[model samples]
Target: MVSSLQKSMINLTQVLRLREHQKSFKELEKLGAIDVYYLEAIYQLKEPTIGTISKLLGQSTPNTNYHIKKLVNLKLIEKRIDDVDRRVTHLTVTSRYSELINSDEDFWTRTQERLESEIAATDLAIFQRVLRQTIEIISEESREDTISD
Candidate 1:
């Protein structure tokens, strides 16, 4: 049985995640529909592959590839050939876009202020720890189910 504190923490994280998603969606809408998903995917992922992105976004490889090609054409992301394997390409955010996205001082400052005001450091740390553990547990369960099937 989950404690009330744990339940509240889960709800708070869900609300925060939803709010961020809404904010990101608004920002993407300002860019363009295709650009919105591309930017959102890039922002969420560390070094996501085409297949991983396709799975996450509920898009087919062909569709994802088409958008990725357009993003490449627009110079938002750079696709580099992996040094270890010439046939393997890795997608990375371009320096130009990194500057544009990272240099949005107003957004960053406002977000920082809101977080500082709303979330305590200790609570935030606990929330992050629990979230990570929950993700690992769920993933392990999924793998077990897959093996059983």
Candidate 2:
């Protein structure tokens, strides 16, 4: 029999719900049309300036501004000028955008509650620990790859 962990990996790889439905997938698709790199830069850069974001995206300032304008129009992100350095403008995701990113909170909670009903808490804890360690290991490997590259 396949282990729970193996089943989980299979489920994640096998399911393509996000790609199958247009209406259901609209938000993600709209954001993706702007390029996944913009979202990644917004997440990883921590309120970086447009120039910084442009550099991170390997795009010209005009191109970065164009994407940023799209993000702003979509209400996915907001911009603020620095008080000390007016030339420095910072970009940040709106709280609503964060909520959109975390849209599966209710689904996960209901799934966990059902899971708890079917399994002992100790077993659940072990499963959670394993998942956490897996995430950490993947993160470490990614960092090592980045550093080596």
Candidate 3:
């Protein structure tokens, strides 16, 4: 059951990613694939340091640093000096990055509206509850994996 669910989720992700890629071709050209991936990691991690990002990405510090420098130059990401440890820096995606990435997207909102129109309200509510529960479970598992690592 879990394996089937995982496959379905993977398929859904691939479909969504394809749609996003089609929508963001210009942005993709502006930021190379690797840099965009690094930026995504930084954004999702919410202000992780170089070491933490390197570990999460399974990348060498120097290689990660190189991409990070490029992102910084592009003004897509900024480094913040850790308040307690001045030597340590945390990475955050900039407002410009968010604007560039999300400003032109309303596909999700449109999809939600379509779903509301097509699905019965009670069924949609149950689907939403299941989706929320699944997300929470995944988040908890991710946290556990991060903690163990």
> What do the candidate models score in CA lDDT, each in turn?
0.68, 0.73, 0.83
**Is 2 or 3 the stronger prediction by lDDT?**
3
| Model 2: pairs clashing at backbone N, Cα or C within 3 Å | none
Residue lDDT tens for model 2, 77-123: 89999989988899888886787756767776988899899999999
- Candidate 1 stretches with Cα past 4 Å from truth are 1-31, 114-149
Candidate 2 segments whose C-alpha is farther than 4 A from its true place: 1-24, 110-149
TM-score of 1: 0.55
lDDT of 2: 0.73
| Candidate 3: Cα lDDT at 96 | 85
lDDT of 1 by residue, 76-122 (tens): 78777778877766677777667655655787699767877799989
Cα lDDT tens digits, model 3, 3-109, are 98889999988997787687765645777777877887788778889987777767899999998998898888999999999999999999988887776568768
lDDT order of candidates, top first? 3, 2, 1
TM-score for every candidate vs. truth? 0.55, 0.57, 0.84
Model 3 TM-score, all chains together: 0.84
